[model samples]
Target chain A: MLETINLTKQFNGQVAVSGLHLNIEAGEIYCLLGANGAGKTTTINMLLNVFPPSSGDALIGGLSVTENPLETKKRLTYIPENLALYPNLTGAENLRFFCGLSGLQLGVTEIEGHLKKAGLQPEAMHKRVETYSKGMRQKVGVALAIARSSDVLLLDEPTSGLDPAASNDFARLLELMKDRGAAILMATHDLFRAKETGTRIGIMNRGKLMDELVASDISHSDLEQVYLNHMKS
Target chain B: MMSHLFYFEWLQLRKTWSFRLTALIVPVIIGYSLLLGHQRVQDQHAQIQELLESEQTFYDDLAERRRAIELGESEVEHWFQNPGNPLVLAQFGGSGRYVFLSPKPLAALAAGQSDLFPYYGKIALTNRSAMRDNALENPVMQVAGPFDFAFVLVWLIPLFVITIGYDVLSREKEGGTLALLQSQPVSIQKILLMKVLFRFLVISGIVLLSVLVFGFLLGIPIGSQAVIPVLLAIIAYIAFWFALCVLVNWFSDSSAINAITLVGLWVLFVLIIPSLISLFASNQHPVPSRAMWVTDQRGIQQAVNEERHTFFESWKADHPEEVMDGDTPDFYLIWMQRLLTNEVIQDRVDEATERFNSPREQQVGVISKLRPLSPSMLMHHWMQQVAGTDAQRLQSLDGEMREFQKDWKGYFIPRFRQLKYFSAEEISQIPRLDFD
Candidate 1:
């Protein structure tokens, strides 16, 4: 579970994330919808404690992220927007490094297992990531998140560069994680994908949370209308 | 967790072409430089041999003429002053001072101090000042510089460091993986340390291997005791660069900017500072005029000879014990008396000139002492010292030859004046003017 209370962030006298209050529970997929520079990334980054909030707090599993980042991080997995790993390393190696950083000491065979499960082809496992395609690299990122097996997953635009098929596959992967009782908070501009995969969607604008709605309560077309309206305001 | 970190770092480095390239290029460059330096030394050795042969011939001709004087050959005395020996003019052309060349085993590594100084010198009697500069090579070549192993290590290695290390962490930030990596259970500091250690291992190995190859290819037999200090220098230089890399990485959020800043710092430290210090030292303590010293010594010797001739005329008036035999003509009296007179003047002039050159010698010493602050300068200083081509050894040998020349004068001057026949035993015992 992840939650934030009136969290705020300021950079050089300019506010980035302000008065953000969110409560999320295990097994829920919360899509944070926003336009570019809407502070969705700032809110998610603060929750992950990559950057500290200027005012208020963020908590992961009842532990404050600011005060106990290590513990909070221990319970969380993050998939960055670009998912950049050491380009010199193979997909399997990238998975191993990030998983190891998270304190998972899996052998080569076990690493290969996670790579296979994350939809990376076995043939590409040993090849360096300089040879890997964008979609394949994303699979490696997903493998790291799954390998960590954290209770919460934070993804930033996880499907922004993927094709429709890959995006569908990613949504299914999120569903599988949710089924496994991992709460996920994703910040992205893909409103349709959010409505498709998310349990709850929050529209954010100009460092403020404009509105929150249940994805099932709105039609897919209406979801865009609500999102556009919120962003326009 | 430690094993995982190590393995990942190893894997990352294994696949990075840039890291591999630096490792390979640095060693090859160093080894090639060593090879070239060794070849240069061999060529210089041949040239030294030719100069030595010509100098030996000049000394032989002088010794033969002195032998004629001991044989009661009074007619040869007039010709002795003008030996007209081709080798004398060609080889003893700058005789009067000696320079010693020492042998070195590892001079090929840098050819450090050898290039700037003389390896051989000429010496003569009676304080003749022409011998001070026997090896008259081009000065510009001495200063233009040589591309040796030390130069490559001191100047080029930092550039390789910047290329391999500048983007270590900042690139991840630029790529948007920093947040994801931080979100994991590991400490960022540890991760950064692993990265730095990885680069250090790669760079350090390259440096050590290159040094070893230099030793092998050039036959540079560095002592076992010297091994540790050489290793220490390499490690310290590398550590300094790595530390700079880490500190730059700490603040900059982009890889490109970090590279630019690191390269800029490298230029400032390696190129700018040394050049600036060298410029200042040269301007502040310029080498006291060699030309002036040469001219002054010559002028003082000439003045002493003239003064001694006057003293001899007064002394001849006071003493009849020095009267020439009836067979000796007045012109011969004048020549014989003036010759003896100039000997005293020669001795005094030599003493005065020694005093004059002492400050110039001290100036060279001061400059050498100040060289160590710059590692490049220190390396060159020690390199020449070891190679036996440094100024001190050369000048000291010249000092020894000056003593030999004085002995030569003592043996021949009296015989030439007395016109006495030398017995076989006395002729055999005449000391040979040998220079090593």
Candidate 2:
């Protein structure tokens, strides 16, 4: 589980994320909805401990992200929106490299299994990622997350620019991960996918979280209207 | 953990064809350049041999002419008409005691001082004047230095190190994977250590292997006794560059910035520092003015010319048995005057030369003290010394040549005094100059 208690981030005299509060419990998928520069990525970056929080703290499993970052990192896996990996390596090889860095020693068979579970094709498993499609590359990133055995997955726009079929596959994969006890905190712009896949949704605008609601609290038909209204005010 | 990092480095090299190409090509380029340099030095050694042979011939011709003159022959004057005679060209080779230097094993690795300094020189007999430098070389080429192994190791290898390793951590930041990578269970410190170790191994391996190959190919003499010091120097030189790379990498996380800064460091420590030091050292330790000594000594001869009648009168006054009616022989007086004039010229020139070379020695001393600041320079200087290309080595040669020049004068002056010659055995007895 992860939590950001009054988390704040400032850059060059401007508040990028201000006084934000959130909690992600075990097996829960919390989608942070926002427009461009709505502090969604900033919140994720702070929570991931990429940069120090300006005024507050990001906590992972009760450990402060700033003071105990390595411990916090051990419990989490991050997949950036534009996941840059060694394109010269095969998808399976990239997974193995990251897994090895995290102190895991997966054999050839295990590496293949993780790749397949991430929805990578059998033929593409051995092919260099430089020749991979965006969807395929994202699957490799997901494979690395799975390989790390992390309890929390921080995904930045995991389904952005994915075709419908690939996006659906991604949502199913998230569900599978959630069932496996890995809490997911995904920052995304796809409201409809949020309604379809996320357990809870939070709307954010101008560095502040406007509202959080359970999927059951909002009707699917009116979710867009509610999200629009939240954005306007 | 070390092995893992090394494996990843190997994998990265395999994956990136460009990096592999650079690593492979750089060493070959460096080694071949050194090969060409060695060949050049060998050629110079051959030329020195030919010069020595010609010097022998000149001496033989001088002795033959002097013997003929003693035999009471007038037709033998034609031998003195040619400029190729030792009596004519003997002084052209500087007045110094000559010492010959043989190449050492590590000469191939650095060729440090050897390229700039002449291998042969004549050390002065009296230390009156500075020994004539007269190294067998083109001066401009000496300044530029040869494209040798020292050049490759000191300057070019660092460039390769920067190109391959400077972006080790920075690329992750640029690609947005730094955060992700850091999120793993690995310690950042451990990761950095592994990266640096991998680079060190790769570069050091390349350098060591190339040097080993050159040693075998060039056949530089090292009979197990002197090999360790040579190898140790090579390793220390390589480590200097490796440590520099680590320090520079720690300061910047941008590959571009790292490359530029590292190159700047290379230029500063390797190229700029040595050159500036050389310049300041020369200014501080200035060489004595040989031309001015020649002028001053020539003035002494002019004084001798004015007092010629007085010298003849004095000789007649001392040697009554050889004088008829107190009139000394014209030939004997002329020979005495030539000998006395030669002595004055030698003394004045030697004094001025001593003044000129004093600064050069001081400059060398100052440059030597700067060795700790730049190990490459130390290695370079040592290697050149070993290869007989150092100026000091040439100075030693000059020292020998000066002794030989004195011998030339001694052999002729005594015979001229006795007024005797014409034995073929005596013609062959004239001492020939040896390079060593």
Candidate 3:
């Protein structure tokens, strides 16, 4: 459902992301593990067509992102590290507004039902997003994906500052989305979450994807060692 | 899709504190300016009404006195006091009609140059001059101008536009919703356009409604089709300012920077460009100072006075019929000499005055040509023109009075020159100042 063929980006002749290839099918969470400036977010941005790729192409559901951005965008949802919604609006309103942009009309009950499924408290759903914690905001982002029934989900460091339980709750939401047949790509520095929640993991260093491994084949400690070694190199 | 964009945009704007403040403040200022404009035009109407009334009374008294004399009810004690005498009817003391420019239907929209030039003037047999009510006073008022609808729309309305639109796109980017919006199917450019257009609609609608409502309450004849051109020009002017805001937003990402840039542009277009254009236009076509015109008028009067005896002798030789052969009143001989000298002086003064005013007319033409550089300036001039309160309209008083003076002289001077007299019944047949 999500693919990149030799995707690369540059800023004033300095490489932000080198030529790279990635593909993730439905019902899988592919986590990109990297240190800061490792070009993980750049990869997600290219796939989202925020800016065109330097040389190669990113495709979603077999449609080229650069060539048909709106067509591909219709099938995806992005939740950045700090997902910013209208601070003056309630979480439910934010969800409804985004859904409206995606051309989906979800009623109040349906919006509430989706928020409930994403583990947002019934009390917080009607409250302004400015009053929401980072973890609670992530739940709203997850609710957007559920309401839209997006085929692809791009997350960039979405759980960096959350408490342990909130991170775990977010992991559970991703798993639920994965089971519902959504291809998820998350960029993170957390090895444990990558090992536990990610169906497959790729460690990146200096704008290059260094290695890929199935989550079940690697222990949390080994994944940490691999990430640390990649960073050192 | 556009409806959805408008609805959401309105919702967001209403929630914003700045927008809420603007919603309340803008209408108040606009309404107040309209009220001031109404009052200004009302004052002009009052002046015209006063002059017309004074003229009617002056003529009625003359007719009554002449009727009594013809009925053999009273004896004429003095020639100067005789009602049937043409010099008495034309020039004794405030005897001629006062001609004035009436206010147009949309006069309440802009005071314009009405306060800087006379709209009414008196026409006598030998002299015509502008009569001022409240024109050309303090220099400060000239710089500040009248507090009218034109000032509000051309100068203050853009501030509201900038306040609302300066951060239309930058807010979304700075708030970090841009990333999420980018992931949506819509382009940011579309969103930017939508936001700017929405702001333009809000500001324009509020101002238009305010002007209409205030104009209605003030009985300003807003129902007249004459207001349509001014209304359309107003909208176009507001759009010009909004377009500038959009242009500023396109290049800047920070709301502060966008606001500063838009304000800088507003200063350039509204305040600086018009001032510079005025300065440049003045340089292109220089008009002599009002002081110079005054000195020239005094010089003409002195030159004409020095040749007054020669001019009277020439007049006596040219028209022998106007001279009484024998037993004429000494008062008649003295008044006839004064009348002939006044006509000669008036002719020379009119020529000098034309020379003085032609450059001023050219200066106004140059300014009009340069108005396109600043939309605010162009819009202000348009509003004034529609209101009949522009510099050209006010300056036209001299010409209108001159024309009316010809008619005044035509009616009374020929009769006075030929020693013709008629009874009170012909008083109504005398020319009355009529303006459509």
Q: Candidate 2, which segments miss by more than 4 Å at Cα?
A: A5-21, A52-64, A206-208, B40-99, B109-118, B121-143, B221-340, B358-379, B386-388, B403-436
lDDT of 2 at B436: 44
Instruction: Give per-residue lDDT, candidate 2, residue B323.
Output: 43
lDDT of 3 by residue, B40-59 (tens): 77787887787778888888
> Model 2 over residues B268-324: C-alpha lDDT tens digits?
888888878878777877766768667776776677667766766776578665543
Best-fitting candidate, scored by TM-score: 3
Candidate 1 lDDT by residue in tens digits, B152-230: 7677888887878898778777866666667776787777777778778778888887787677656666445655666
Off by over 4 Å in 1: A12-14, B1-7, B14-17, B39-99, B104-106, B122-143, B242-308, B311-436
TM-score of chain B of each: 0.69, 0.74, 0.95
lDDT of each: 0.72, 0.71, 0.86
Please give the RMSD to the true structure for each candidate, in Å: 6.0, 6.2, 2.0
Worst 10 residues of 3 chain B by lDDT: B427-436
Report, for all candidates in order, the number of backbone clashes.
7, 38, 0
Q: What are the runs in model 3 whose C-alpha is more than 4 Å off?
A: A10-14, B136-140, B283-289
